[model samples]
Structures are given as structure tokens and as C-alpha cells.
Target: MPRLIAPGSLRRIGTFFSDSGYTREALRDTLELSELPWRKLRNLHFLLHKTQEATALHQLARIFYLGQPADEALLRQCIPGAIFGLMQDAEMLEVKGGVAKPACMVAPLENLVLVSDQITNMEVELLPDLVLLPNPTTLTVSRFMLRKRGANVFDLGTGCGPLALLLAGSAKHVLGTDINPRAIEFARFNAALNGIENVDFEVGDALAPAEGRQFDLIVANPPFFVSAERQFVFCDSPLELDGFSRMLAREAPKYLLEGGFFQMMCEWVEVKGQRWQDRLDEWFTGNGCDVFVIKGFEFGAAKYAHERLFEANPLHPERDIEIFEQRLAYYRERNVTAVHGGLMAMRRKAGSNWVRIEDIPHPPKECFGDDVVARFAGQDLAAWATDEQLLDWKPALTSRVRLRQELTARDGGWQPTMQRIDLVEGLASSLALEPPVASVVCRLDGSRSVREQAAALAAEAGADAGVAQAEVLRLVRRLGSGGFLELPATG
Candidate 1:
């Protein structure tokens, strides 16, 4: 068991990864494979075709990212001499039979250097059961997570501590908790590897690790896989379908400060007889938190079970399909209809709270956390606004918003058809627009108050000013809530 990860060694290795331009795109080009081929080929594909003329990046990539072995001469050529010595001293290098093997996987994810279990590290006896690695779920939460300066943060079920390390750059303090002790150790080692000091890792159950304490921000990507049995500690949950996600959503509010935020990527069940929105709303019962949920892809029970079962036992040549069948049986017995995946954002309020459930099909080009926070603030402002008060304010279209009207061949001529408006950058929200209403929105250039613009639009449409003012007021609230328009600054 190689345990020690010296800080000096990490810094030198981190520099090498940086100078080598080690990115997903780089690897894709080097491997000469697209997404499908990459999935089919894994790391073994690289070793099976290694050439004598492999570059330094290629050798290092295979050794560090793919858990392959390289000769001492090749490692020395790829890495600086001092850094190579430091790696050997820190137990990252296992020398045997004139070949050096990497003990862990160190790769670049965005700007952070993450350390996790190698994809095919055959020294399974030394590693713990089902240790997690940096996966798409972690990347999803990381991209959407809010960063608050000088605030206390907790990462519930932190696997490799990537979220915590990223937050430590902005947060005053961070605590990462996991039930698996090996995960805690890897997280701690990664913190040192990245030279991040404001974060700490500990072994404890979800939310139990931070009991009797309140934080300004908390983010979690818990073990939400609903399973018939807890075969893997990293992904499986002992609770029923969506039981773990519901438990955290229900309990995390009590551990947050007033006006604080708790964000987590989660999956919930869509029961056969119940609406998914209503079932998810039940999770926030008795809460003082305003909830925003953005739903993503959904899967059926049998398909989900088969996919998970296949992922769990990837190295095994022979698999018992009966295990997947057994998991599907549980779902059938519980009358489960489908499984829905999404990310949820909760802001702790004083008393009154609201919930928004949406499926934004478009992906946001910018970070999502800022857009969520802005919408919540806009919602609060709208909740207290009188119709008269709302009419007095000037509103501008968001820079990220755009209007599109589909073209239809009517009478053998291409003409305008249905009009739609959507956000182009931050958060993906779209709404259909009547041509008349769309015309009115176009006139809103922030040059005048809503009262003035609506009156102008009314005159153009031959409608009464007072009547149109009320209608435009509703649009103002809708656009503001959807992050399509920027609201006026409130006192």
C-alpha cells in the first residue's frame, strides 16, 4: 500500500502535466479516436499499439493516466530527474523488474490536478472496495456549484475531494466527508498534491460529519444509485429508489445558515402514478429553502440496472445477468416508472420559500451557479412587487438572451412561423412568444420604464394603455424569473 504523497513531489509532477498540455482534447488527438472508439478502447488500446517513437507526453500519459508501466530510462526521459526522484520517494513509483508503475492516476481536469485510483490498477488487493474516481457527475456539480468568498463550505460524500479543492480557492474553509476511509485518504492526498491547505477530509456518514454546525454553503454529489443491494460503497445506496437524495434534500436545510446555499447533483424516481415534480417537491417538505431543479436525462429501471451492473463489473469477462434482473425486480415490486437525473439548488431563506422544477434541454455556455443565484434574487424581488410597483421599473434584455422565429413554407414562400425566445449563454431556459408579444418585447431597450413601453405597445396594437400595462407587467415578471431579462436594482 503506497500511502505517502509528498507536497514537493506533487508540485513538480503538476508542472509536468501543465507543460505537457495534458487535456482531454490532447489525449483524444494523440489516441486518434473519437468518443465511441475511446469508450470501446480504454487504456489497453494505447498499450497494445505503443510505438518505439512515442513522445514524452505519450509515455507519461500511459504511465500516469492509464496505469501502465515504463522503463526507468523512459520515465527519466519523460520527467525531470529531480521530479523523478521525488516521485519514487513519495511512493508514486513502484519499481519492479526494471519497469516503474504508477500507483495512482494523476490527471488534469480543467485547471485542477486530481489524484484518484487508476482505471486498471491490478494491485486491487492494496486498494479498498469500490473507491470512486473523477467522473461526469463530479464534473457536473463542479461546473454548476456556487463559489462564495469567506464562507464555510462542506462537501458531503466527497470522493476524491475535487469539489472541495476547487472551493478552497474561494471559500474561507472547507470540510470534505466520506463514509469510505480510503476515499478520505485519497482526498487528503489530493489536497496536498494540489498544494491546497484550506480544505480538510474526514471519514463520516453523509451530513453526520458536520452535525451541530451550520455552513454558509454545502455541495454534495452523494451515492444516489438506487440498488437492490449495496454492492459498491462509492455509488450504491442502501436506501430505496431516490431515498438518499430525498433524505439529504430534507435534512440539509437545517444545517445551513439563513440565506445560505446547498447545491447537489441528484437522481429521483418518477413514480408510475405520481407527477415527478410533485414527488420531488415532497423532498423539500417543511423547509425554509427556495429550491431550483433542472432535470436532465431519464432512464427506465431495467436499463438503469443493467447499465450500472455492467459498469460495476467491467473487468470481469463473465457476468451474471441475473443480478441485473434481480435489481429490476425490486423496481417492479415498488411500482417504479422511471429514473430522472438532475441537479438541485437550495437557498435557505428566513421563512417563505418557493420551488421551480424545469427541464432545460439546452446547455449553458457559462457557469450555471451565478445564473441560479441571480434568478432566486429576482424571484424574491418579484414576490413582493405590486402591479403598480412593477410597472414603474425599467427592464433590459439579458445580453445572453436571443429571439428566434422558425421559418415555414406557406403558399410556396418561406415566411415567419412560430416565435420563441431563449437564453443563449448562462442558464438554458426557453419560452414560446406570440408575435405581438414578441414585437412588444423587442421595443423594450431599457430606454424607458415599463409604464411607457407598454403604453407605446398598446397604441401600436390598438389596445387600451391600462389593459396592456397589466399584461406587460406579467411578461416582465416571467422574463425576470427566467433570467431572460435583467431586473432593475431594488432599494
Candidate 2:
């Protein structure tokens, strides 16, 4: 059993972690044992292979992340003696098979180190509803969250409290809710471990615990994985075919203050006839919330199952094939075409809400919360702006926005083959420009209106100004909506 670390001991442990450079930002892709990075250790792969050098970080990682037993002497030497003693007293350090091993796994995300079961490290026993380390979805929602200070925040399905911990820094108060009692314990343990006081954990399911509650921001990484069966509360829910995710999208608006934002990571099943976008668009119907959906990589239903089952069957690879087939059959029986997953951001607007959905295959190298929030603001401006207003507004290209020319080698020399304009360092999106559109962009320097620039391009190319005007309007709308350009004056 994993016992809670005492508040007094948590401060000491936090100080030790800070001094040791034990952080997600510090260990990102740096903690390597054999061939795997630290983040990849989230998967239950056995990390019995240790590097030649035995630094404190390397040894601690072996004990904490890989769930391998460290010699009692070596553990005392690597970890602070007082903290080690505290952990031992709290039963966090267990002697299994005469070897001292950590009772739980610790994963670093931003400023916090989340504690959960080392299920992937298990060699024999298997059970459903096992707690998991931070996966891509956990990182995705936390990374994309808007960091609005002094806001009341809620983290639903807050497994191990990674998202809630991250939000506590900016939110005035943060509450994490989960149906699993163990998850509530883990989340609370992590909060005390990090000495974070603004967050409180509650054992509650979905929005039931949040009825009649209002928050300035509600951030959830709910159990939205599309599966025919519910095996785990973290990824699988009792709700059918993304019902829980749909409920959050549809009902979370009622729990938010006016103009408040609700962001979550979710998955949706694409049916035979209905498009995933259309289904998702319908989710926010009559909710009075403006939505922005950032679609991520999707897979055929079976492939998604195969990948998911791989994580669950880490200790029994031989059984993965069987489990995969079982999961795939369930999806096939339900007629799930493709399971689409992504980030959904919604704002509880008063009336006449809008929906913006688009595909974003690759995420940025790191989270830029302000940049993402600003994209929604920029979208609002571009969405409502008329062609005449756009021209009159004379939107200035952001400092980060730039144009790049792609050149190809010919028989003799390289020649410009394509022109692309995008936020060079902003929101990680782009706008490919044709000759005329490229010409118009070249002159969008806050120096000329769209109409004036279109006329200049028409004169230069001997084309109709009306044709140029219409084409430029289309390109500008795309550029603005996609965050390739922005109107600073409006802001």
C-alpha cells in the first residue's frame, strides 16, 4: 500500500527534488538507460538494464521510474537519508523478495512529480483499473491549458493529479475530481508531495460532483478513449462510444461562468455516415459555448485497440495478440470507422456561438498557452470580420510571422518551387501562398490595406482587380483563421 507522505516530510522531499534537478523540464529526453528516454519509461517496459555511470539521478530513476529494487545502502546514499527514512516509515519503501523497492512510481510533469502504481513493472499479477503514468494525452491537455491566473479551475478525471498540479500554479483555486477512490488518494498524495495547497481532490464521477458549480476555467482530461468495454477509469469509462466526452462538451458550458473556458482532451468515434467533425459539432449544439477542436492523429478502430492493449499487456506480451483481437472485434461489431482524438477548447459565450474544427497532425515542441488562447481571440476577429472590414483594418503581420521559399534543384541550379507563409514561431500552423496570394502577403506589412494591395498585384500581373480582390479575401480569411496572421489593432 502507498501511504501519504507527511506534510513536514513533503517539504524536505520537495527541496531535495529541487536541488537534484529532478524535474520534467530537466530530465526531458536526457534520462536514458540503454535506448529509452525518460518519457518512454511511462510504458511498463522493464528497465533492468542500467547505464555504466551510476549518478544519483540514474540510480534514483532506476528505483522510482523503473520500479527496480535498489540496494538499501545505495538508496540511502542516492536519496537524502531523512527523506528515505520518512518514506520507509510511511511504507513507501517496501521490501519485496528481500530487495527494497519503491512501492509506487513517480513521474515528473512540469513543476510537479506525480505518484501512481508501478503497474507496468509488474511481472506476474494483472488487474483492470490499474493506475498509469502520464501518457501523451496527459501531457497534451496540460500543455494546451490556458494559464489564466486567479481563475477557479476544475480538473475532472484527475488521475494522479498531473493536470490539477499544473493548473494550481495559475488558478486561484483548483479542484480535482475522480470516481476512483485510489485516484483521489494518489492525487492528494501528489499534492502534498509537491507542497501544493491550492488544489483539493474529491472522489466524484464526471459532472455529477460539479452540478450547480461555476468555475472560471474547467480543464479535464477525461476517460474519452473509444472502446466497447470499460476496463479502466483513466482511459475507459462506462459511457458508451464517447458518451462521457460528449457530455463534457455538451454540459460543461452550464458549469462555466460567462466567457469562461473549458478545455479537455477527448476521442470520438466516426460513424459510417456521419463525419467526426459533424458529430463533434453537434456535441456543442445549443450549449452557448464557442468551440475549437484541434484534431490529432487518428487510426482505424482496430489499430487503436491494438495500440491501447499493448500498454495493458506489457507484462504479458504473448497475450497481447489475443487481447487485441478481442478489442478489435468489439469495435468492428459497433461499426466504428475511425477513432479520432484531439484537444477540445470551449468558451461559455452568451449567444450565437461558433465552432472551429481543423486537423493538427503535429503539436509544437513545447506548450505555448498564451499563443493558443490568442489563436481563439484571433479566430473570433477573423470569423466576424467582413471583407471590407479586413481591408480597412489593415491587419499587421505578427513579428513571428514570416514567409519561406522552398527551392528544388534543377538541372543547373536551385529554383523556388513553393512559397509558404506562417507564424514562424507562434501557433505552429501555415498558409501556402500562390503567386498572386504570395504577392498580396508580401505587401501585408501594415503599410497597405487588402484592397490597395490587391489592386497593386492586379496592376503588376495585368489581371482583373475584382478577381484579385476575391482571391485575396479567401486567402486572408484562411491565414487569419489558421493563426498564420493576426490583427493586433483589434486586440
Cα error, residue 22 of model 1, in Å, equals 3.2
Q: Write the per-residue lDDT of candidate 2 for residues 390-466, one digit (tens) a residue.
A: 77657566678778899999989997799987676634777777866787776777777878877887898889989
Query: Best lDDT goes to which candidate?
Result: 1
TM-score of each: 0.91, 0.90
lDDT of 1: 0.76
- Candidate 2: residue 274 lDDT (0-100): 81
Clashing pairs in model 2, backbone N/Cα/C closer than 3 A: none
Give the candidate number with the greatest TM-score: 1
Which portions of model 2 miss their true places by more than 4 Å?
25-28, 33-55, 95-98, 311-318, 404-417, 488-491
Q: Candidate 1 clashing pairs?
A: none
Badly placed stretches (over 4 Å) of model 1 are 28-43, 46-55, 121-128, 315-320, 411-415, 488-491
State the lDDT of candidate 1 residue by residue for 355-421, as single tens digits: 8777864446346777778777677656667888877888888787789889999998988888889
